[model samples]
Target: MKSKGNLWRVSTTVSQVAQPLPEDKSVDLVVIGGGFTGNSAALEAARRGASVAVLEARTVGHGGSGRNVGLVNAGLWIPPQEVIGIMGNAAGHKLMAALAEGPSRVWRIIEDAGIDCEATRNGTLHLAHSAAGVRNLQERHRQGAAMGWPVECLDAKETARRTGSLAFYGSLFDPRAGTIQPLSYARGLAAAAHEAGARLHDQTKVTRIRQLGDKWIIEANGFTVRARALLLATNAYFDGIEMGFRPEFVAVSYFQFATAPMPARLRESILPGGEGCWDTAVVMSSFRIDEAGRMIVGAVGDLDGPGRPIHAAWARRALSRVYPQLADLPFEHDWCGRIAMTADHIPKIVALGPNAYASFGYSGRGISPGTVFGTQAAIALLEADESVLPVAPVRTHRERLVRAKEVYYESGAVLTHALRPALF
Candidate 1:
């Protein structure tokens, strides 16, 4: 329902126009959902001189796009070999190579469009939580290097120096990765699309879509728009849309808490290299410092759910465990967002019909992949080509144990957080 928590609403301001849909209109393309994917698609299509319109059930960045962890990392959460294993050699390699350029594509767009979203292109650290975790990083580093990725496997001593915390055993640092103010970035894309002659309508919920003789008729709030092609980019916020497209993915929630800006001395000592970080634990946790010096920590669970207290307590303890100097500081803001977790943990581009597609399921890695998929999907539809696309479009995608998996993720996170002391 709600798009953002205190951090987004308080720290960022979106510049997109939310005019209601007109009584009747026609465009070369129509996009559903106004997150990064929809907005990026609209921007790409519009930039190519195609008339485009974007419909949003809620305000811009109202889903994972706005609430994301903002790690603009290359590739998926899994190793390159795992990706190749899942999609098979050809398709998986195509996807992998395509996404390897994700961070560059994202940052270039940000710079080219002048999107002021606090983008820091320093890099990211995939930390190892324990001795076993170090083994995982070694393998990831090896695979990444083999694939020509600029990855570095740091020893624990170097990890401590870079992170300013001794909690991690080692780290896998990818120089291609970076961070951004997610909500601001999404809005920036929307604004760029609008400037490029794309029409974006917010608070205009599309009730139904029916193909009408060479055109797609989209019935929204109080109007109908006819388009030659259609795109459904509503990653995790599809329930609000009435019909036509249903993406099957297990839902997982990720929550983040930001503390008040640290003192200059403390800030300099923490995350000295300014790289965002997440660990190798099964129930992983992330920590990073924003431009304003707030230390934002996040994990995989709904902070507003029944386990809110436990999640909050775990965050506090986790903070102390890593950086005890800031343990006395209080959290200034907290929020949560849902992730569309596919059965295989890969994003899907489902072909709805001729000239139509729905893209979803980025798991927790939404920023880079969402932007890449959105831009590429638009190009593929416009040019009637799939070669440039990451993965071949599927007619349908489903996850069988959706509800069960959702519960399992949250339960695992709660149990892990509740039993944090024993593990740490």
Candidate 2:
């Protein structure tokens, strides 16, 4: 997975690209990967007066950070109790409590650093695609409310008014969550890090990282960075550093298509509140309106794979099915990015070696979780403490039947999308 420019970079007008990594140098921290997590770690560490250097295989936001759905959501996809079910009581509670404020952290950074990436704080919707979906939302609402989250369940009428679509039976709305220009946010974080004395390098991939005594020797871009700590925040786009347990997870592809900005009348009536949305289905789908008024819809399956046509046609039909008023609106931009999905659908923080860690497997929730993990991972490394991390650093993380699971995911998405119209 080398650097591939995405729709975010093409459409965004943010100015935060960094030069390549230095030929050779020594720093307190070396962050491998310029996505949300790595950049946040660098920014956090550097702001605290630590000398930091961040290296990216491509330009800033070139990875999943640039290609994500841009949903700045709080918490994980599941409820707090389900989080407990996965990671046990104490650890799960700690992780959930920390991530519960993830969106707030992002908004605070955006405000403090003045990063203009279309920061919308209105809210986000978890729509129910069917009666079963509504029941799922009800359970989620119960769990969320019990955990003190101000989650609201909107009925069919409110859902229709908020989304300007009648496709969903209901929706679970979270006021703490919102949307952003993901690529711009990534670039903004890099710029803020650089301004805070962190050295950021683009197009410089770390080929190898080995410990020399207590310090780390990170080799990349025909140079080496000798640092006391290192953070691997590559997420779903690990190009190099092919050593150790590199966060085993299925690389599920998610594609999005952005339509041309709608006319004012249509825009006013469609998704009038500027809330990001995703439906609750086995093979999930998401849609949002950007600051420029363009509608971006996304779902599983690769846009460049054998299921390309199936996925593309599914997108067109799904968009029409959801928003009949905007049917036949041609999509202007179509792209795909990989998601690092663990078997448990939870993120992992793997302790690579002494003073080194790699955080990945964000599932599809990158923006907030990436920030939390990256920041905590860096703090843990700098402070020599694993207690600060959301997930206790694990020595190793593994995935089974990866290739088979990848096929299962794609085939399942294609099958679901192919049959969705009739099923609905």
Candidate 3:
């Protein structure tokens, strides 16, 4: 069934006016893409007394930032040891430590800015879908504990009690992570950035960018913006604009369906502690309860494509298997968004030019990483200090066979949803 619309768009309490580009302007920084990254950078740069302007093609949070699962998880999808193996000790540790603070940074911003996004810090659960998944969680818990993180390994009975379902072998709980109304958080960032002296223009798509001496010139909405630094934060929803450099990653689609608010009794029994959750299956799924008591379930695959019916049917069966009490509940909202999945699942910071950077490839861990990267990118760019950056900036990054990889991912998701047992 076609979705009524994005639940976040309809339910988001935070609002910001999308003003057009006022006129040709000069600033210390020009940010393209007003999602979490761009807006966070804008807010940071402006707070540091830099002249900043953000140009967004659509309204703030119109991209994956608005349509995500809203899981404010810490670290990347890969475990910390894998990250250290790939990036080596120093750089890997730097990135992990920075991202480990992701949830707190998000909460701090919400508190300081008085932005109400239904902010919750109760933590998140990483469910084990099978015995192999259990081992994976055990390894994750070991790695996190070695890093001095407060990660706990829960038994099957405790997992069932916490999640209100007996669908898993065990679970890993991270007290640092949480959930939020993602769209509202994006809009709140935009609003806070605007209040902190950053100029933000929505419906302003940048078409061209060029460097003149030490300044970067941006053309958008028939206006010219010359700045000393630039940040391309479009991620998976990058519009077709030639900014001399393109961020590359395999774009994978993820869709979600939300049921209407359940009764208080039902809501109290399911996820009563307000934890967000996702399983360890290869084609994983996430489920969480919103502030209004609505249960949202999401997985890989395009909900608007030919596999829509298959995915929609799978959603019902999957939810029923876990929470049989909600089997007859009808989904009232559905939406889909793309994730910029990197080969190694590590985010990249590309040095576009002198004092300029473009960050992408969060690999489905956008909220915390985006916030950390955006804030660090701004500080590193404005202060001319590469050491301030979480990850060392590279000259260029290229992903081969992006389209084919996208197809492979979507097809795998569709095939799994069609053939996998409901008990899984």
Candidate 4:
């Protein structure tokens, strides 16, 4: 799919690893997708001595993995207490504890691989946009602190000082979080996997997948490849392969606009602490600085179709509202992508067949969860032990009414963006 605007047109620094599928070949593990999850799984599996092959419909990281907000956050979109409430204490706690170290694990791999994606470990801020939002941040701080997380609640003044934006009432800072060039990071993983002896096939779309005897036959691009195990990491970009098991979720679109590199004087005053930020609004807004010092502001909306006008208007107003200093800053880039969201907002790992699994539904929180889940999935498949996985693989579940939900989300974003400036 073509991107909507220039935001995705910015050149990523990561070099693409070269490997395309042979006319006919077989591997121990077949990973369908070349994004973070698939590449991470391939890397882990290959490191464990399993022969792995990764198939990408496009180039590696061409999906949402390339167009993310770049915040390397450490937890799920749902709070800890709510997660426990939904999944029961034991299961939820297990998942939470495993993911609590997600950012560290991601950075360790980046450092060890010597991938230069401009990884910065400063931290992240969950900004509170209203009085109620402040209360929410307070609760998050308390819960995170109780769990031994390095989280601090900052008052409005402190938040403004750090962010250079008085648009928030308060903020929750978590030292466990950070940011990266998402596309470069994903490509880095692919490169590491390639170096670790995994074969990566770009522009090879998997058209049909079926079980042939005890082996899995995956047909793509006029060729067939057999594998002992298969892993489906195609989240929102999943086409028509019905594995008899799929994620129960909706596809919500999120758009981003990035300005050209700010003046050196203004860059120091804006996001000086090098933390990525997002506000606590129903229709949330995110702001962060890229490695090149470009200010990227994003929100939940469709960058394509007629709703583009609404999103464009809101983005302009939002930029002015946050930093009047950059009121006239020309937005040079704009892009959007889909996020898979489960009804309960938790990711799922579903067992589709013997030695086959599919993982999806990270909502908008992909970086950490994708790496953690992909790595664990590789271990589980290679070692024949699911004990190491953060979430247990299930056999089957009901798919959500995704079409209706997607329409609803887009409609809501369009309406909200159309009216946001007036309310402000």
* Best candidate (score: TM-score): 3
Give the Å error, residue 176, model 1. 0.5
Please give, for residues 207-323, the per-residue lDDT of candidate 1 as tens digits.
Answer: 989998989999997789999989999988887555556888888999998888999999988997789999899998898988899899999989878999899889989998899
**TM-score per candidate, chains pooled:** 0.97, 0.97, 0.98, 0.96
**How does candidate 3 fare on TM-score?**
0.98
Pairs of residues at least 3 apart in sequence or in different chains that clash in candidate 2: none
By TM-score: ranked, best first: 3, 1, 2, 4
Name the runs in model 2 displaced over 4 angstroms. 1-5, 422-424
What's each prediction's clash count? Answer: 0, 0, 0, 2
List candidate 4 stretches off by more than 4 Å: 1-9, 242-246, 422-424
* lDDT at residue 420 of model 3 (Cα atoms): 88
Task: Choose 1 or 4, whichever is better by TM-score.
Answer: 1
In terms of lDDT, the poorest run of 10 residues in model 2 is 1-10
Segments in model 1 whose C-alpha atoms lie over 4 Å from true places: 1-4, 240-242, 422-424
Candidate 2 has what TM-score? 0.97
Candidate 2 structure quality by residue, lDDT tens digits, 52-104? 99988888888889989999999987778988998999999898888889999
Which pairs of residues clash in candidate 1, taking residues 3 or more apart in a chain or in different chains?
none
Every model: Cα RMSD to truth: 2.1, 2.5, 1.0, 2.1
